[model samples]
Target: MSDAAELGAFLKARRAALDPADLGLPPGISHRRVKGLRREELAQLAGISVDYYTRLEQGRAKNVSDAILDALARALRLDPGEESYLHNLAAPKRREKPAPRRVRPELQQLLDAIQAPAFVFGRYLDVLAWNALGGAVAFAFAELEERNIAKLSFLGDRGKELYPEWDAVSREVVANLRTEGGKHPGDPEFARLVDELSRGSAEFRALWAEHAVREKAQGWKVLRNPVVGELRLRYETLRLPDDPDQGLVVYHAEPGSESERALGLLASWIAADERPVNTRSPHPHAG
Candidate 1:
């Protein structure tokens, strides 16, 4: 449950998930004993001694300097998001307590100003807030438990129906959640979410076992909008510089495209619908 154990488990799990072929390692003749890369292979790729890597995995060594962390990150071919997770795992504890639950005020302003479908999410992919257009685009929000992205993506029955490419989105969500779990294995909320989803959705359980991890950035999604039928929108995860742990997810479409037209239609629908009273308290970081 300690941070070090969480970091070690994440590294090991990610390493085990990688196929030798994925990393350009030769496929040995004998049937592989482990699922992913072995300790020796990972050590070779990382330019570290196998003994050292083993110690790190065992959580027996506490000398994880920046150099070693960087080396391991590169060996795994981690993207910027995963690399950030690695650094956060190794960071020293702060003296002050972390902020309580809620979206920051500045983030709220940023979300409100955007005309496109957009929402802010916490480190755990919890929906902090969404703009009017964003809410309109995802009407499934009403059925979702607290508008948590992970919960909606996995547990919400309407979620699968709402997404055009339900299976692919489910896998991606589970993969990202797995990645977060590795980085913060001891996080109570993370554990609770994983447990809830795993029990609720068979699809989530299968994807979780695949050991996939993905950065939540720009991607395309075909959403089945109740107002406009189906719209293929491009979504981007905008990382917040000051907060570091939160990001604004903005969805847009190419000009004059069907997607754009659909978005406009959704906007009109939102304007017509009765506005729900905002009950969410202000997040501490809200400036």
Candidate 2:
């Protein structure tokens, strides 16, 4: 979608996500046609004219001021991430960045040194690199059609089994993608991926339409690994200052717990293989 269209769609989605009663709004009409706040109600709340808000919703308003954006944001109760996404949509055309072609030797070493499963993700959520444990614990990476986290979560055959908490995990993936989509509105890769996923799964289409924006920095995941049974692991994202486009995600279990012992056994099973896993890519970019 064009920036104007995306801006309008985002506004509509957010407006629909709100509750009228939450803001002390009465049921003004017995046969109210719209969900959430009506156009007049939102305009009144934002201190804007109803006609102007209508224009904004229709993508007819141009050169949208920060003041207006701020007012709408407040009225909609947008969080920091959503507000930023709104701003980005209004002022689209942020430049596309080139992805790194190869992980640094030091970076690859860092992943290998980690005791637990670890992997690096590119800007578009492609699996750029993964340690041996990551390979064993998470997926058979090389054999997969696409190394993208979004595709893996939604489109892959094993996605549901891999993530026992499928709904939450899948939403997280979509939210993270939405956050990226907001920042780099001009990115073709982002558009292509969204189109593919939306076409493939009705769930993906529904979640993508939510316009939820989030940066998943840290979280707990219950992964059902085939080798070691269920792994209740806590994952942390380490953003590289030198390369902001790439990040290392490490997943570890609590010390001395059954999950931890299972991880140890998993690691041992990984080490037992005479052939070392291919943890680094000659060409780092996935697409």
Q: Pick the TM-score winner.
A: 2
Residue 80, candidate 2: Cα error in Å is 1.4
lDDT of each: 0.74, 0.84
lDDT of 1 at 110: 75
Mark the regions of model 1 whose C-alpha exceeds 4 Å error after superposition: 19-30, 93-100, 104-110, 140-145, 178-186, 273-287
Tell me how far the alpha carbon of residue 229 in candidate 1 is from the true structure, in angstroms, after superposition: 0.7
- Each candidate structure's TM-score, on Cα atoms with residue i matched to residue i, is 0.80, 0.92
Tens-place lDDT digits, model 1, residues 126-218: 767777788678754433346667777777687788887888888888776665555554566676777888899887878776556677778
Worst 10-residue lDDT window, candidate 2: 278-287
**Per-residue CA lDDT of candidate 2, range 1-287, in tens?**
87788888888888888888898886665465767778888899999999999988898989999999999999999989889999988884656666664578888888889888998887788888888888788866745556888888887567898989989988999998888777777778778889999999888999988878888689999999998899999999988899877788999999889999999998998789897677764433444
Residue 191 in model 1: lDDT: 69
Clash count list over all predictions: 3, 0
lDDT for 103 in candidate 2 is: 74
Candidate 2 pairs with clashing backbones: none
